[model samples]
Target: MAFNTSGFNPVIHSSTGGGSTCISGNVIVSINTPGTKLLYEAPQDQVAVTESFVELFQINSTFGADAAAGGSSVISGEYSIFVKLCFPNDPSGLDKIKTVQLLTHGATLDYTYWDISPNYSYIDVASAADYATLSYDQLGVGNSDHPDPIQTVQATSQVAVVHELVALLRNGKLGGYHFDNVVGVGHSAGSMLTQAITHSTRGTSTP
Candidate 1:
């Protein structure tokens, strides 16, 4: 209930799919994850961005996974991520549930992609089914903090952010709701992040 609401939209209703009320806001997340070097130099323009991608692909194709192999240091940062938490408008038992779906959007898209409209809104569908939903703008995308693109926002750091978010949801730090269960849902690149989180054994020993 005491979530940071700076520059956040107040409560809103989704009527197209069903009557679902959502609190659109932002949360500050801090995380530490293994870091890797940028495969290609940072681009200066749109064309350069494309060229950088091409170069990265060529290097990967030529060297396979070895091209990206390297020792990793711990990368840490505090970032603000835009998030929306929604629940069914009707007074069903769903409001008391602690389970939630954590949604992450693909590259080039924001949290809005999940709730494009009432008719096509994923949040509305979940709400009607008596499930709570939480969607966020991944770091370096949309309203979230944008750090050094090539260095700080790599795949490992993105996965770390998602893991941190899952911890927050489970520990009752986010939205003051303690969710014992978290289901991660992602699109495209986001799906890769979720997969990494699912299969990761990074924090096992905590050495």
Candidate 2:
């Protein structure tokens, strides 16, 4: 809820897409200090479905501006940016598939996961079922790789994997493992998967 005012600045940029050309030049401005949770409001002009913006955050090295000789670089601080699209008066114009694509593509290039320091890690839910199978195989007593059997449900597709993630995030055996430090990021359809898991986690009581 509190803002990180010590080191903070915000920049905004805009562009036109779809079949239209860029009308107004992209805008960029810096904020002296801002809240941790920042929102980028879309512009009123360039009201066509094609115009959009992107937000980016730059994280400075924590160690130092420059890496010490024969040593690793450090992170100094972090920078964040957000961009939005301006659409015509049409209530549903913002939700159009083409407009969404333009916005997504622009934002993707502006902000990349790899740019963030201390690379973030996530549970590989894509192959959760495979991991479960391997876990079961390792538990069998007959095989050298086997020891004891553990119960697991099969997750054949991304949807199933998402369901499993939601269960774990909510009331599954590992539910207690949830913590504030965790961050979730997904792309394209993966975003929907994360949303489903997130929705399932809400309003659930801890055992």
Candidate 3:
């Protein structure tokens, strides 16, 4: 149903052409979840944040942002997210555009994990199933801004960023293509993040 692509390119676009769809670029998003953002703007403060990150991981308190701040703080950053849209190479693939599957990868990995190689690709599978697909780099990962990983890059803020991306998908901002439905599909921590986004956007948000 969707076969559109344009500028906003940051990562590589397919050289093969026409069998699939892809749009990528740097997107700046502001997430308000309460944490420290000041450290990233300074040198020594950045080191302190890194040290704190190590300590938190050592103690399994990576979710300690809310506890440390006793509340929420604004965590905003410029992120490089790619919406690799899969349109079926076949004519019937057009109907796949009606519903989109948003893909997110786990920690120690990025979006490309889903499309490991030509031998196996989730995006290709979704396309063949008549389901449009979406995959992006999680905020603070890959080409995204590394905002104080211990504080600003915690669960709350990351989930909020996903919500923002959902909104964009619904609004047809990534490319000229838009879908009537969207489903969040993730792996490990990425899956957990999607669950949080689903719970939080129950009121009035789409996708």
Candidate 4:
């Protein structure tokens, strides 16, 4: 994976306690892979929704392997992902904190899901605990760029985006902070994406 970033926020002071600070930026990620085209159609009603799932399950069970065996032209695109990094004011030392949490939200949500408010924000909670947090709006959501949903915004591509983010954090490219340990935290569909990252990048550098 290769990426470029722009629109970096120098510093955004948190109004919440614990003297936490935040910085946000947009990253443009590009990857090359066979494009995924789903044949399923959008359901119109509750019953149709169930029927659509059943139909998709049956189709996958029948032709999934054959489809996987087929080859196609690579689909590639650059997606701008909006991300925020929050940490406690390091009065003691930055070296004391070497771990960062990578937060990913489920479908129909964005980065703000982790930061609903000062009192309820997970970023604030982590900062108060002396830990840093990184949250991002996945492609096609929030402030990020939107490409063809079925082709460029597939699960593999989503994993690729998060993977590059981990690289940036480990290499201190974002906020000039290098974290030896990066953790993955996700909700619902985001959890599946994180699991995919762990599985696909096994025996390789990943969160």
lDDT of 4 by residue, 1-207 (tens): 111223465545562343567777776666665555654344669999786567558944654544344444466777778888877766465568899999999998998888776577888788778888999999889899888765567777788888888988888888777899999999888898889888887887669
- After superposition, the stretches of candidate 1 with alpha carbons farther than 4 Å from their true spots are 1-18, 56-71, 92-95, 201-207
Candidate 3 has its poorest 10 consecutive residues by lDDT at: 34-43
Off by over 4 Å in 2: 1-156, 178-185, 195-207
* Model 3 C-alpha lDDT per residue in residues 38-88, reported as the tens digit of each score: 323323677887876776587656445534544446666555444455556
Of models 2 and 3, which has the larger TM-score? Answer: 3
| Cα lDDT tens digits for candidate 1, 101-123 | 99988888888887776589888
Greater lDDT among 1 and 2 belongs to 1
**Residue-by-residue lDDT tens digits, candidate 2, 27-92:** 122212211221223355765313332112234432222212233222112112222222222233
Task: Report model 2's TM-score to 2 decimal places.
Answer: 0.19
Give each model a TM-score: 0.81, 0.19, 0.73, 0.78
Model 1 poorest ten-residue lDDT run = 1-10
Candidate 4: the clashing residue pairs are none
How high is the CA lDDT of each candidate model? Answer: 0.74, 0.23, 0.65, 0.76
